[model samples]
Target: MSSDKPQNASESELPQAVPVRRRRWAPSLVWLIPVVAAVIGGWLAVHAVLSRGPTITISFQNAEGIEAGKTRIKYKDVEIGEVTSVKLSPNRQSILATAQLSKEAADYLAEDSRFWVVRPRISGGGVTGIGTMLSGAYIGMDVGKSAARKSEFTGLETPPIINADLPGHTFFLRADNLGSLNTGSPVYFRRVPVGQVVGYELDAKGGFVRVSVFISAPYDRFVTSNSRFWHASGVDVSLSADGLNVSTQSLAAIALGGIAFETPLADNAGIPLSDRNFILHDAREKALQNPDREMQPFRLRFHQSLRGLSVGAPVDFRGITIGEVTAIGVEYMPERKDFDMTVDIRTYPSRLDTLSRGSRISGKLSPQQLIGNGMRAQLRSGNLLTGQLYVALDFFRDAPPAKLIVRKGMPELPTIPGDLEELQRVLQRIVKKLDAIPFDNIGQQANDSLKSLQQTLDSVKALSDGLNKETVPQASKTLEQLQQTLEATRQTMKADSPLQQDVRSAAQEVKETARSFRALADYLDRHPEALVRGKEAQP
Candidate 1:
């Protein structure tokens, strides 16, 4: 009731006028802490999304030394990425390696980019990746110049011979076979290694093997249009007209094989185009031989054995090689009732034309005229040690007259017997003559003669013995008597011998009588009466 009544106006107004004022809300430091932390966390999330790189998968025949989360991809020994995982392919035939690369390596992932597992290797280019033996294997990278990007790739089984970044030129070589050459096989210019074989494949027709090679610059410029390439593998040992020849590029070529090229000094060498195609010869001599412009086929019929003579045997004119034997066969001669060896040969007339520049022939004589003038072919020994034979063409003034015969389409050239064959014929004739002699009859006659001689010798010996035993003593006694008689006669003829005195006295008496007769004759000449007188005295 007192409230309802009008109270004291000042007390009532004082109680109503005392209005309550709400205190302003105050902030805490704890709220500021959570707001700052949220801003930092947002910045970190955006940075992580921007820093990640592209992922790539590579296929390999095998993952021999590859490791996940451990092996790294390197370019020129610089780390560019890492292998994250390894697994088999869907076909279960190959291994697939998943790698994460840095952003800088994204451009290197081109269509032609090459990758290989680096391990210790010994090849024609020498030993490489030895450092990887201790550090473990890694994926090697070679960046390509292709503009198109790729995420999947097939890795190389072996490292590339030359890096893509290396300045060089590529060329193609065609060969009959691959020989001992392989990727990374050395290529030489005058035995100096200037390049390597990068790859090889068979031709579309499968008739030949085509090899691709890379020549480093400076040396690449040396390969000209006229340059000749040949296999320098192992040792080339040949016996030709020049004699035995042994050649090789290097010791490496003997083991791993190699190739060599050279430009002839006589040829003008122009710059070669990129990817130029050239023939790869089997030997250096064949590569350097001058091309023959003219070939003439001719046939030769030999009546003797063709042993030691081969199809490629040289056909020589005097001492110069002018052709080669192309074919060898046996043909039966119906007229002679015997078999004759037929040899087809190819002769280069251009070689003779060049050699006859200042000679008397001067390439003017025809084949018919040459054959008419005593030209003939003969087989002779070329190499005594190898028992190799060759056809020799020369003038045979004593040979029987023979004409060149053309049968069917081939012209036949005349042939004379080989020296050995001629000698064999002479020996056979001598043997036949010797065989005609009656050796057994002659031997019997000789034995009879020896018996007669022995009888005569025995008779002579018996006679001599008889003379020694009986006739010799009788002859000695006769000789002694003759000697005594001769001594007596000698004594009788001495100056004091009685017979000599008698002869002297008789001779004196005869001389006196003759003197007396002479005196009487003189007296009778003076007187005729004295002729009748027996004796007359001289005055």
Candidate 2:
């Protein structure tokens, strides 16, 4: 093979022949740039597709504290999304936030989910959100998944109003002041927290205020009766020399603008309780329900001089509060100068008896029965140290107190007799009778009579008592001596021997004579017509 191949030319002969035309990059290098660009573009596209998520638009009245891209969406306090874009709404009215929600939280975006902004509340009642004093502000939302619901959300002007879903139609309550009541302040029934404050508003009417409450399911049924939406602020009252004062017993319920109701239990009624969620969420659609007829506004009048007493004071009957004082006003007609308080009371008549659930007059109980076995109206001291008075209902009969009534210049409600008042009246009557007496004459006569009577009685008692102790001993000794003298006289008469012998001789003579008389008496006894009797025995 080596012999067959011809020897190559000198070293430079082969390749130095052609300085292979080199390709240029400024032009062809631009093609390489295209390849690099393709790789970068492909990377960006993959990232964009994989990180894709849903866009949720939330509109707010103001975006004072919320930041676009910084705002987060949450469900049950868990962060599920972040805002991506911020812009005014199409109407140029609201701060529209375009947020990207994590897929994990999307399922919770329910049709009934709610969104609101938390802020400080300033009112005459009191201030709320001490947190806002430091934490600035944030958005609170209840998430739900409902494609049917509007994808857009409008943040509430007021904070979220937490309330218990009640039975029947939801009530509309408006107040001028909601106090420091929070979104989740517990609503109570006689001090028992049964519901909570859910949200509030500056009423669409721009007047008064709107409060949203969440009544629990069973408690919602209690709302079968209309409830009073009042302030649950401070319990206030004043006590003075004129009379007892009281406030905020049952009316304490209104202090916080909470929900309270009386539900009548039944054996055959349909499910009267409503679900426990905001009706505005979805239950609003089913708000066409009729309320129970038996649930009526409890009525009571505080016919008294309510000096310093407020309208929202509690009205209790026998310690069990049945209502509250809604309006404290006065009527100037008929010379009956009185401050009459119109009360909004609530009473579940069917609940009067623990055993009876149905409404029937047959089960009507007497006031006394209520006091001992069923019910009692206790006039409670709203503030014992304050001497504020209120009414409470319960069963306590160990004490049968006296009734109450008006006296002096003090204006009083026609209250059921309390133990205290009855005692007062009796004392007053006795004092009046004593006042009617001529004290000077009676006192002198009584003094003289008491002195003479005491002396005479003392003398009689002393005479009888001393006779038994002092005179009886001497009388007993004299009687014993007289008995001994009689015995001695009888023994002396029998000691004479002549007297004994003569007595024997006479006895022998009398015996012969007695024999003859006996024979004669026998003959007379045979003669039935003969009389043989002493003068006294003849008849």
Candidate 3:
């Protein structure tokens, strides 16, 4: 029994057919971490496969500031993709760059998509992409409207001015020449900058430069069909009757050329619209001096030289400007056998009326009628200091009769001698009158009169000398005898002697006649017409 117990203990402790606890074939909690991790990895792999995006290739002339890993593609200033690779094209003429775009941006890639490198640039409008300097260069993209999907694009050399997101309208400007103007030039509204020039191309057939310009929303409405555009780049200086006019848009505009526009008066101007073409003038005067009515060309032939008269000289009607001299020519007149000056003038007939529009009544009075009514043209002085001459039209009731001559499809205006010529004619008449005076005959008559007067004076002096020498004693005796005779005559006249009475009566009659003559003289002085008709009796 002892031995059996020992063996049983040994067997129980060691080798007894011990029932093996059926090992619950369960995985450890630590092992479960790997399975869950593997399942998540598989799911992420499947999601990544489903979310892969399209790869697009872009061709560029030069890969100036592009790097594959560092450069990013942007749209509306937001990152949308990354550049994967940049390689030289097989032809070596261009560079082919590959970009990987996010799935969200895949739909935006279309046939018309445009891409350009964003870098710091100074354009006529102003400095652009300055912020890109610090951030390094990147690819700028503009989404296209085309519905067709595409994965290849031709890159642009410069940034685009027209885009869907941009809030502006593009218009065309036609200029004879682009002076100091370039792409990105500023467009001004009354000297205030409001737009920019995007591009320009020469029209070979039309012989004009067509510039594309963009104006923002509110300013765009100011562009009308009657709007005038002019170059506002440099300082405009003009010397006129008013004063010196010096004008400029801004300091920046002097360095970079600019365009300016102004609409006509509200009463006469038309409405504004987008995409309308406008003519760009070279100067402000040309733009502002828009004539409201049509002009007619006329010819004037003058006998005097056109030395001071030049193109742009004013044609005045009674001191009011009505036209301008456009051309001056010389011609030899066969009839007159002299060289005549032919002047071509452009006149706005509408200027004759207060309103620019002419009426039928005024239009009926032809230019021929005006010429018949003594309307004539003459040269006048405009500026005495500058010696500039202008044309003057006036009426001279006594002007020589003349007729109109049509030459080269133009009517010739009758011209008369200017005021300077009239003065010369009057001077010549004065000289002729002076020459007709009898100066030699008058001198001979004056000499004879002086000789006769001198002879009479000599005789009177001799008689005075004879009286002083010999007649002194005789004169004393004569005076004594006269005094005695006067005393006797006085006594005889006072008394009633017959001879004295007769003399006294004669003196009284003489006194009476003198009084009558004095009265008549006074009456005649008071009323000289009394000689023609006797004076009326007072009532």
Models 1 onward score TM values of 0.67, 0.36, 0.56
| Deviation from native of the Cα of residue 171 in model 1, angstroms | 3.3
Question: Model 3: per-residue lDDT, tens digit, 301-391?
Answer: 8887677889989999887678889999999989988998899998876667644454543476778898999999999888878878999
Number of backbone collisions per candidate: 0, 46, 0
- Please give the lDDT score at residue 18 for candidate 2: 45
Model 2 spans > 4 angstroms off = 1-44, 118-138, 145-147, 163-186, 199-212, 217-255, 264-539
Q: What lDDT does model 1 reach?
A: 0.90
Q: Which candidate is the best by lDDT?
A: 1
Model 1 clash pairs are none
Model 3: lDDT of residue 417: 83
* Each model's lDDT: 0.90, 0.56, 0.85
Candidate 3 local distance difference test against the native: 0.85
Q: Pairs clashing in candidate 3?
A: none
Model 1 misplaced stretches (Cα beyond 4 Å): 1-51, 177-185, 199-206, 231-248, 266-269, 298-306, 326-344, 358-378, 395-417, 424-539
Candidate 3: stretches off by over 4 Å: 1-59, 85-96, 110-113, 123-126, 144-154, 161-163, 240-242, 267-275, 282-291, 298-346, 354-362, 371-403, 407-539
Lowest-sum lDDT 10-residue window in model 1: 266-275
Residue-wise lDDT of candidate 1 within 1-539, one digit each (tens)?
Answer: 77765666556676455678989988888899888889888888777667667899999999999999999999888999999999999999999999999888999998999999999998656788899889999999999999999999999999887888899899999999999998878899999999988899998999999999899998988888778999999998887799998999989888878999999864546565744998999889778766677788999999889999998899999888889999999999899999999999999878777676646453678788888889999999887788789999899988888888999889999999998788889999999999999999999999999999999999999999999999999999999999999999999999999999999999999999999999878877888776577556668
